[model samples]
Target: MPHLTIVANITAKADKVELVKNELLKLVQPSLKDAGCINYVLHQDNVNPTLFMFYENWQTRELWQEHMNTSHVKALNEATEGAIEHVSLQEMTGIE
Candidate 1:
């Protein structure tokens, strides 16, 4: 089976960029340790400091969903409430 790829784009509220960034950073270590996680990398836009992106690869869609339900992810949601301007997510499978 092909791996599941996730591309998540996040835009932070103008005043809350650093807060959102710190909260997002807290997810990295735990996500990397999650079952079936092939890789989880975070990126920040060069031209827009308030924009952030996560490029993730998982063994399966189910495992990626599991990662989304993890405690750390939950905490991230709670911590960033109202601090985000917009979020977009794309789930894809690499074409081999």
Candidate 2:
């Protein structure tokens, strides 16, 4: 199987890093159990306090796209509306 890796770099504004971390942590399970998701993990940058990373794995690209359109995704998008500086996402594939 060709596993999917989603790399997300998130920046927090207004010193809201902790707040966003807490919010995002609360959001982990919903995404974890979503249809094609194999794993969903979140981490904070050591040097850059305001930066966060989310590494998500999925069974397929199509299912990952579906996960992005779910209601929980919408809620997350809304949660970070004013508190986030920027978010960048990159999709990659695992290699043997």
Candidate 3:
């Protein structure tokens, strides 16, 4: 299967920016250790600390789906429910 690329955006409530950021950062290490993960990187907006993004590469789309079902991911969802204002995720495949 072709590799998958994921681009995810996260917006946190102003007051909970640091908390949300810390939570998201915690996922990186474990995500990288997952079987099909090629890379899992997190970034923050320069002017807007509450805005974050993730760039991920997985060996297959199924692997990425498995990542979503992991305990850490579920924990993040539950923990940041209100603190996160918006989340946008995009999955892509290279054309060539």
Candidate 4:
């Protein structure tokens, strides 16, 4: 069973949402191929063009921590540096 769940809330620059989404897609597709990652998804709110949510499921907290330290993930963080106004995260544990 997956041990850690990650959720990230993102907001992008006004006209750069599409571009941000594209970058996120590129970041996540490769991330999902990692053994530690179970899934990675980005959700855009219908009412807010600049708002997005990232949900990632990891095989273990250790692996998730490792993922947080990876270059691609770090690049993704830097990629959105000035493009985002707010960034928050929530992590949950599955009972199963």
Who wins the TM-score comparison? 1
lDDT of each: 0.97, 0.89, 0.94, 0.84
What TM-score does structure 2 among the candidates reach? 0.92
TM-score of each: 0.98, 0.92, 0.95, 0.86
RMSD of each: 0.5, 1.1, 0.9, 1.7
lDDT at position 17, candidate 2: 79
Candidate 2 clash pair list: none
Model 4 CA lDDT for position 64: 85
Residue-level lDDT for 45 in candidate 4: 91
Consecutive 10-residue window with the lowest summed lDDT within model 3: 72-81
For model 4, residues 1-70, the per-residue Cα lDDT tens digits are: 6479999888888887887787787788778877789889989999998899999999898988887888
**How displaced is residue 22 in candidate 4, in Å?**
1.8
* Deviation from truth (RMSD, Å), model 1: 0.5
Q: Which 10-residue span in candidate 1 carries the lowest summed lDDT?
A: 40-49
After superposing candidate 3, which stretches have Cα over 4 Å from the reference? none
TM-score of 1: 0.98
Model 1 spans > 4 angstroms off: none
Candidates 1 and 3 compared: the better one by TM-score is 1
Arranged by lDDT with the best first, the candidates are 1, 3, 2, 4
The whole-model C-alpha lDDT of candidate 2 against the native structure comes to 0.89
